[model samples]
Target: MAAIIKPWEGTFPPFRMYGNLYFVGTQPASVHIVDTGEGLCMLDTGYQHSLYIVLDNMYRMGLNPHDVKLILLTHGHIDHFGAARALRELTGAKIALGAADREYATGELDLSYAKELDMTYTETFDPDILLSDGDEITLGNTTFTAIATPGHTPGAMSYVFPVTDGEKTFVAGLHGGMGINTMCREFLDAYGLSYDCRDKFQAAMDRLKEIHVDIFLGNHMQHNDTAGKYKAIGAGNQYACVVPGEWIEYAEWAKQNMLQMVERENQR
Candidate 1:
């Protein structure tokens, strides 16, 4: 909690993961771009302080900020949606967030976990689209289905969509949030949040395990070894991010990790 986040210090070079999807975020947080042919669909906007870097990354990737038609957030956390308002204003992109996490974005509930990360959430705005489970967000040639995956947050959501590389199409999945900071006993008891989110988190992981994801997208760079894959792509592996078995492995690991934390807390 004492960590001071210097958003600018975490800039990473942007590159295309596969097909029309591109990575344009920093080391601390991950941002993705979906070139839907008609307009761009931005996955999560990183911290507000690092917005300029994200924009610069977009330009570096040959993407137009003005053509961003949608800013779809994976959850309500500040690190994920901190730059939403400013970005929407700049691109006129409609901001879409999970329905359960609406209050986190609007500042109605001081639970964006900003303070926990040693930051403050100042850019709050109403989401143009309040997505629910099974909701579909369509733009141009791409459509993403929203799946409710709570536990990380009450409104955490995972998106599944199809991406194409001209001749072949691959299914891509972006998991919302998996950090245990909010679900851990210390954090829950301190914030007066329920412990039920742990159960929800475990269930969400199980549910996600059943889904077929060819390309697993991580909200943070470490979750997917984005840097390693980026280098691999540079070395001529065009489909470096595609690992159909990764989804199940990550989901199981996340579920077991949560269970272990709870067990440790009980022992304490």
Candidate 2:
């Protein structure tokens, strides 16, 4: 197992990303705040210790935590869902996640890999909304369609929504999980996952290619060059808004990377 390290300890200033979307996470986890016009919707929470960073960023952007009506998780990974319980308690927001990931979050299944890596997993609470593929999540003016992309985990989900640049509305996509770090035998044994992760990942990529994604976001910033894109946006670069086909290219690249990993493991 790789040594666990705190990679996202630093704070990042919150900024609006086009329309009603805001980035309010640290360097490691990518937490997105979406304004639905009725209430706020948070995408993913960082680790338990990173909760304060999220809250502080929200406040910095003139967003009240209490106004958050929904907390949507990408997966059940500790880094992704760690602050969910606390945020829900603090804001009374309804929490939602993929049904399969809910089992891992609610302790119905073991997540010993997290313990091995010295990550924290404190309390577990039931999700108010259990999501499935193709399910529509409507919150005021914002609506998102869930796409099951089970590679990072059995219940990993991607979301497709709309974002406007004050004039033209474009379809935006947020890939739920991108890492195949849990594909190793040791990690799978610890978590008791038996699915063919590589195959599922490829299938998910194939499905994603069919969707037109003008704006692509990832669960983690690094996955989508988030920091760089944000910098471009801040600098008023015309290409800051990515080209429409970038999502398909990214998916293809990710799928190929996973295939290479599988090949390397087979050689061993």
Candidate 3:
């Protein structure tokens, strides 16, 4: 991952992940908190002092005393789950996530993160929870299905949050790296455009369509950052790559992009 990436730090509506995971990064970065009324679940906790930032957000947003029933890490990346252990201490929440990621988090399994890979690991640790694909986790009247989508990391997983707003049923795709972010921009660039790499990513991303995502959200807020991390980047001349709307657009985009790449690879 791009180590130079800034932690989540800023204000509200300031950042919204794929319009699915609503959150704003702060100065020191904040915990990516998702609260469905009394139900609260953190997709991923950020770096040091970041947990408190989320706690602070809870107060500001009137979402504190948040029933953080569970902490679901999208993967074992340092930035993604560095503060997870702390949340268990602060919120007393149950941790449920991917089994493969659990291996990487606990240090039982270790993979060297290279520049091309856009990840740097000084250390690796084990996760408390080892979840498998098709496992459904319930927290505060809500249930999130674990769908293993490994590409960024051997064990990368995305959580499908079941949220109902009025008459609309929202299925949120909570991935650690669902879309382009500060980390992936550099990582994708560093990795270059090799047919092998493209093929692999295409294969990995092909699994995205297998699941239903009405709202696409990654661990980070910005969909893509051609500029500063927080700046929205999608649209004409826009360096940011996100627009607030239904998550279906994101789901379609991911599938179409993967297919497009696969088609190009076949053409070549």
Candidate 4:
């Protein structure tokens, strides 16, 4: 029997978020394309089945797949890295993933949770670039600095870069992982994770607050209200640019939520 796919895993119409950034994936997983003048750099790839949607949206926007120079993955989750292999084959682009995720993706480490969820695993492939904390990846005029934001996964990485809306340029940050899906004691114990997982998650959030982010994004739409913000952008709302304080507020909210989860786990 085939597993039922969630509605959010379906395709979504792509739209330009700002100057060079475009949203081109479903509501469940976000795939962003940044035009770098010299070529294109992609951030995240939805499920493998959703690659056609991503490619079609790019084509509709008059972007050729051949022009894709880099494919940056936020993490090793199936939803985020599922289509990476296909994209690399189609575009011959250099694929990059955080060191930890790269190990998981290339079969160096086993992701037991994926087996528990009955999710499809990404085809093993060696990443062309292995990212580390404070590493910078430059392609043409765009430079993305990788920030180690470990919470969802040990190697979860966020990216900070400059994004423009033609009239103005703002420092944009895309948070790699936002959910505490594996934070519970049961899951942590089964996965052999240390009790300090919660503490590390909190520290990551603390470090994120220190970064000034005028435009904040998340790997999933639900994390940062991508659909809501996209609608506002379509309606010509200038407030869609987002403010730095909003990032701090969101980080605080995430931290509080995780802490609450930890409290509940303790009571259990």
Candidate 5:
């Protein structure tokens, strides 16, 4: 289990990943802001304790938190949606989460995986919008299509959308929850959760491989080497995150990793 004694310790400098898509999250969790012509669409608010850092990062980047019209969560984990209630109160942004993760967000179940991080989820709130597969959330100039990618937490949702750079457009896909920590046999047995989630995870990964993603976004910084790519950006590669083939490769690896884990458990 990962213990985060100080959520604020993982602060990172925010920057723009593409045109209107900006990376405003911290070093631990990845948060993004889409400057839709109408308003801002925030993807994944990090830990509640670190919300002030996110807000500060947005202000430093000249992005106003009050302009946030939508808070689209990738999952219902505390590290991802822990600050949703506070953010909504501050900006009145409508919170949207996967339909299956509704209870997770509402604190009805202690399934936000907060215990894994040695924390408690005390900032839960009812989501304004419960998302399903193929649901398209349209803001001013952007439309995010939600793809149900359960397993990580049952209602983990991947999203695909078009990112424009004024002169050109590219498709970006954010994998909802790829971590198999919760899907492991011991974890499942401890929680009395079904083993079927492993099957769903494999299927979800396979289906994601079919989509064409120009840019791959990760909910966690390490998944896509956010730091390394940011360094490459400083070295003058403005489009460092736009590698077309990386998404498919990562998707395949994620599937294989899970399979290997299950294999190891079965062997034991």
Candidate 6:
């Protein structure tokens, strides 16, 4: 199973989160492509093995390689940023990421702090530019901000943007942490990242209160399941998410749910 998922899985038009943002799932990761009007941008290219699939999806989305100006990454996980080098070669787009995660992406940093994942430094490339907290990226009338949130890894970041035009402010939760996945659940049980899951929960909760987030979404897979709103990522079926703002409510709940999961992991 590689990244070429059935086109039907995404349905037509893809959920237009906004006029500028969009997503497509590949085998190893979900590709977030953006059109800022200055040109195209992407977040988190898929695994090394699925490079072509990512490129193909870009074409499917009507984006040419040359249109891509920047590839902003969530964090340095291999699957998330592995295709960066290839995409860069094709598009000549500069890559942006948290300055702290630079080494982790290029394979200079091992990221031993993370529990079950054995991230090794294999090859390294410098980020053309470094992203810092509160920096706003403007594309004509639209703007997105970078928020620094550390837990999954130091220098982990989530992109926050307004829900839509005319909206005063609403941050889209991207890459703060995994809501849940096969690897994540298994890793939690196996590595036991924290003894105090409650602390982790509270920290995220506190952060949420400080921001004006009305919607929540996950890349790669589904993290929120309510009614027919979502299909869990691992499900081998076509699906899409709805009532997205409900996701933030789930994040509020995930804070507690994850704490419990951690508690169980610690006990295990």
Q: How do all models score by TM-score?
A: 0.97, 0.92, 0.65, 0.92, 0.97, 0.72
Against the true structure, candidate 2 has what lDDT? Answer: 0.81
List model 6 lDDT by residue over 188-225, tens digit each: 45655443434544575557546655555565555533
Clashes of each: 0, 0, 22, 0, 0, 2
lDDT of 1 by residue, 95-201 (tens): 99999999999999999989877678989999999999999989999999999999999999999999999999999999978988789888898889999999999
Q: For each candidate, what is the lDDT?
A: 0.91, 0.81, 0.54, 0.81, 0.91, 0.59
- Model 2, 1-268: lDDT tens per residue? 1212543446777887777788898876789988888999899887777788888899998999899999888898887888899988898999989987887888777661367556656667788999999999899888989999988888888998887656778787888787878876666766577758868888999999999988888777777777888888789874465567878988988888888887887899
Better structure of 4 and 6 per TM-score:
4
Q: What are the runs in model 2 whose C-alpha is more than 4 Å off?
A: 1-8
Q: Candidate 6 regions off by >4 Å?
A: 1-18, 112-123, 163-171, 179-202, 224-244, 265-268
Compose the digit string of candidate 5's lDDT tens values, residues 3-113: 245766788889889888889998878999999989999999988988989999999989999999999999989989999999999999999999999999998988898
Residue 245 miss distance in model 5 (angstroms) = 1.1
What range of 10 consecutive residues in model 4 has the weakest lDDT sum?
1-10
lDDT computed for candidate 5: 0.91
The alpha-carbon lDDT assigned to residue 122 of candidate 1 equals 86
lDDT of 2 at 187: 69
